[model samples]
Target chain A: MPVETIDRSATDMKAEAAQVSADIDAFFDGLLTPVQDGRERLFAAMRHAALGGGKRLRPLLTVAASRLFAIDRDRALRVGGAIEAIHVYSLIHDDLPCMDDAELRRGKPTVHTVFGEADAVLAGDSLHALAFEILADPATHEDPWVRSDLVLELARAAGTSGMAGGQMMDLAAEGQALDLPAITRLQQLKTGALIEYAVEAACIMAKLPADARTPYRGYARNVGLAFQIADDLIDHNGDTAAAGKPTGRDAEAGKATFVSLLGEDRARQQAQMLIEQAIEHLADHGDEADLLRGIAQYAVARNH
Target chain B: MPVETIDRSATDMKAEAAQVSADIDAFFDGLLTPVQDGRERLFAAMRHAALGGGKRLRPLLTVAASRLFAIDRDRALRVGGAIEAIHVYSLIHDDLPCMDDAELRRGKPTVHTVFGEADAVLAGDSLHALAFEILADPATHEDPWVRSDLVLELARAAGTSGMAGGQMMDLAAEGQALDLPAITRLQQLKTGALIEYAVEAACIMAKLPADARTPYRGYARNVGLAFQIADDLIDHNGDTAAAGKPTGRDAEAGKATFVSLLGEDRARQQAQMLIEQAIEHLADHGDEADLLRGIAQYAVARNH
Candidate 1:
């Protein structure tokens, strides 16, 4: 349960995670060319927001999950890129003046700060729409039911009841006490929902049996919670340079967090326990889930 | 072309439009119940925003355009509801304090004003996502190619380079005399893009031939322009009671418009011409295009 025993040096896993993240970037960069001349400017903004830096966790989760179904890299990458686009769009909108109002994200001025809020907002809206557009593309030739379910899953994940609703709760809970239950609910909705979507959609896209999907969903939900709690711990304990943004933001904002409510020691313990539970859900899938299991463990143990 | 001679009484047409609008509402109302109890509240927000009210122009455009292919009322109505959801989402976001800052939409308080800005923003975001979710539903069993293309069209119409892009231009161009071309581009991007999407999406959903989509797109673009110009004119000359909102908002905001740039008489003349051109594009399609033709004409002629 000790942090030192489980914590992996950021440098140890940084190379591979960074590679996966780059693969995601490259995948999206290839799709961004305008099919028509008039589309030039819009495509440029799409690239600008998309190519911006991040951990690429959601997309990575997607690719890893797809791999479990024995889908090849190319197909996984396309769907992964699409999920990342949605993730990027969410970040852009979250940074808007009316939302989180952060001036920085991914070690640079956020999209709104660079592009102006209206463009940032529109970029987010457009990119979110484009996610479904890409998923439903005829080139993918995914089954109609699969495509429909993907759209439905994503809409629910990103919608008012999903990430945004979680955001509302976070905002309302700011400067207030959030107990373990409230914290679980908040993180589950906000971050866990999308992560669950990424994993489950990958399973759905690969046409995995319903049995495979059910457990994968559980695995994903647990990993998502662990990932968020780790974020809270890091935000409290991480160095600003290593963390890529200011640390202790939650503390400064007086936001309710597992760390704040449960103490850093207990929070880290809970994260590990959740990660273990997550990996256990994938046991029936065997080594096909190794990357997913690796990432789940990494979620809690990574330094930044 | 005489303004006085045009039968300006849109009540009967409005009543008919309202019935179609009601059908669109009923479709979504019956369809959006969440499977999970926790999700139903958010789903209710989605339904509330979609069903609450609007001019229903976008849905009307969808139904009218699809009728051009054939009166496949079921598909047309579903697509119509989907398009209306997108339009409503845009309005909800556009009216936010960070955006247009309007107090009233469709004669009632804006969504953000009633729901709180955060919920309103999420509601809009969800609505945008849900638009695709609805369009891509398995129950609809729409062709994958058609659904994909429709998704793309909708994305492009809503994205940064389309409606969102135009909004940014308007924000930046406040108090400036955007040249005639600039004015056209702004309106086209801000309003025309989605209007085009509505019309084109309907045609695509109907499985119309590719070549046929071109004229419909043209018709949509033209009516989109006329609609904005007429909106400007109404903001100048229409009655507040008839319009169901305040008159003269554009002028008060120092926003550029066709009516503001040219004289009122010229704006009216231009709107008439655009509607005529919109109608002309439907020439080969004949009486099946009547609803579309009538709506375009009504767009310019309506007091509201």
Candidate 2:
């Protein structure tokens, strides 16, 4: 695309992401409305954790990928909402006392800090259950096969060999020297797995051809790695206020991160390179994939 | 049925339960075998939590229910294994420091006590994910609709409105005096929900007529309540060694339970009444449901 067209699409992508964020918020609010005899405290904590705030980038990726195939935007958003719930739940549990022990997230007190540890744990567990519930619902997709496919893929992405395994690796990585290959594999499993699922879910919804899925998968892989590298950079140099959490946590913990292993300049250069390659994977889709392409740029470009 | 037939079936039921327990253990072991370069710690913790000795009553219930419609035994076992995973995950999380702070389970060291709290949490979380994955796989059911239905029901049973919500209520009830209705509702949500799903899943697998489901639902509801009441009674009067964990914990915590509210004699009577009523719900099913009837009796009759 031309320079002017690229800039316009970037603006469009931002607006589109904002719309998805609002839609998902409303969806959760309705889903979690407290009945007279409901567990109000648990619901309140879930709302507090889920609705507090984030970029909603994963949902954006789902929506963007769905748009590439002219699939229903509303369906994509609801599925995206499920993905966001899984993401938020992971964050809640990761911040617990036994884990990272983070007190603040998204510029506010973490769920365990505000809701008490038990409630926080239950809330996170409930959110994880809710994600599968949403995906399995008929409203998410008219075809049962699609819903089942989404559930299977999402479960794999979230389970032992994927994000959870990555987390275990991270805990083990503390104070241990990890090579570049190990760190890369760790990041791929920890965060990349879910991001890849976000895009994959859209393809499933669209019933895209298997051949057509390759580019999107390649795109998602590169974008995910780039996003993590950018995150490491932010932790290394970004302000705590801007990042919405304490910075330099990797250094403080002596954790083996990409920045720690490769140095800041090389890490930045690699992230930029990955983003470029991610955009290149979208070459065949023309203007229809502009939002996804824009997201690739935004992944490494964002300060936070 | 004749008295002789009933006596013979009860013996058969014990043997059946034992077989189901062994089948589920093998199923879990096969499901959790570490892949090349897999996260061994997480897998080990999951195996520890899941494989430790228990009655495996939930899987037995599922198997017994499925047998009513002459459903495939292997298929039922796989679904039962998924249910067991969910049950084990709940126990693991409930035993975490932030929750029950339990040191022992099934007469063995708890997951957190053996593998550290972080691994325990991830194992529980990953097990939750694995439950849905198992259900969604084509191996669980040939029809995607059936798989989707199973996932949907299990998620609801495990989510905020079910097990997690009940947990929240239990936490909130710590110091508060709860009446009979509140306690009943709590138990129904926490334990009854999953038991209901266990029977309901078999119905889905069998494609049972809609009206045929009512009796099983009634049977499960009564059995669930009876099971909890029995648990409360055991905590009130049984030996800690036999129970495999601390006994009289409800009294120690001053948490209101059926035993505390109804007194020991009345509580025992209540459980017996529920078990009898539970058996009556299966009156129309003949000897095919004998195992389920035996399970109801065993729920209140067991020492542990």
Candidate 3:
């Protein structure tokens, strides 16, 4: 049965987010149970970073996208969890003193602040390894090909060309004169890659033909950009408590971002346009894609 | 036709090491060429760490193991290169000030020392991602099952129950009391896991049946432990320039190591005994296993 129908209001997405957050947390809790060794600190730090936080938007996106093809829910969640693992690892490293240096994440002290830098780094590395482990396990899928493809997809999304690469671009851009295109390209690599991987994973799981992915790619790309812009806007205007971390960091770092390059009003307009375009990519589907549509709308809507 | 024969001496293995080292470095250089984007710093750090440093013993072990089965040479090297990437990434992170806090690795400044901590972390993260990316690529193995299986094996070697978990244990054991068994288990996870994976990757690439793996794994286990003990011995007795890094770190930190627990003479003898035992695990093979035997001898021979 369909979980939610078309024309669903914003309240429906919140409920779905809550459910996904709980599921992902439970999955990590069970998966990260400390082995009978002295590595309890590592597991604890990983749990601290990965559990009980975030909107679970990436996993939610994977779940929502999987609905477009009627894929297996549990399998979809597993894929989503791997992607979120990558997301969480990046966040842990990003919040390090050498990086963003922020002490708060998810409304609490960051991993390095709570666990110290060594454990924080190892915890993040463990999570990074976990992403591939989860994807490669037969439990994720019976077909080895499916698992291998997912590993490839997620690895690319997390690697230098994707998240890490984007991070490098961001680091290099700090206090430099990055124009509109440069900032857009930087954000595309840093955040857009994983967001695209979320939906692409669903496509891979469903064994959808490569040629059939154009619309989904378009949907994912548009939504990812829209989501990033909304993030910059929130970082500009929203309070730290609401953001679960410090806000206006872009301005503080003197870094160029969507809001920096396009001005606040135009950036907001661009995000709205992208969301509409993202939804337009799903015109081929009906009620089955309602969740994705909700997610696209939610991309910009999260800031409000 | 064979690389070397059963009676090959330490000089022959050194030549082989130099060859494998060059091949792995070239592979990384080609793979890590920075995009036109300004992420050169990240790529530079990765190249600085991966390109010119270690003995490439892990990849040599991989190459040597693959020779017994006549696996595709380039494919075997790719697998070896992937394994070496993990080794390099781990070193980069381990040398961070929060961990070993060392300024030197491979006779030169460590990644964090040269590139700043943020870049160091990103470079290591990129290399970690690169390992999976290399394994998952169609070039690594034509069969998806083979690629997927390789990923599962390497991920297991690198994850919580393996390398990362071992690092956590080592961190917690600092200046604390750890007995012989605890220290053994720690080295097995921290260093042995990767060394074992080096051989396991060869078995995986050769399509050696799971049931046929007992001897190889036994060999791996013994050689890995022997290698660790030899490493500790080197740290205990060898000078900085010879070992390529600071020495006597374990005793200085009051951390119990193979050398600390077993004592200098005992650890040296234990490594020698383990190397012989490792060689015996390959008793079933004849002239084809010559390199493996040579490596077993080389493990203990390195310290001498």
TM-score for each predicted model, relative to the true structure? 0.87, 0.98, 0.97
Candidate 1 on A184-229: residue-level lDDT in tens? 9878877888999989888877777778588889999889998988
Q: Fnat of each prediction? A: 0.45, 0.82, 0.88
Q: What is the per-residue lDDT of model 3 for residues B78-98, given as tens digits with 9 covering 90 to 100?
A: 999999999999999999999
Model 2 TM: 0.98
How do the candidates rank by TM-score, highest first?
2, 3, 1
Model-by-model lDDT, in order?
0.75, 0.90, 0.89
Number of the top TM-score candidate: 2
Worst 10 residues of 2 chain B by lDDT: B31-40
Pairs that clash in candidate 2: none
lDDT of 3 by residue, A32-150 (tens): 88665799899999999999998888999999899988898899999999999999999999999999998999898999999999999999999999999999999999988899899
Candidate 1 chain A weakest lDDT stretch, 10 residues: A4-13
- Model with the higher lDDT, candidate 2 or 3: 2
Q: Model 2, B248: alpha-carbon shift in Å?
A: 0.6
Candidate 2: residue B29 lDDT (0-100)? 90
Per-prediction tally of clashes: 0, 0, 0
Candidate 3: CAPRI quality band: high
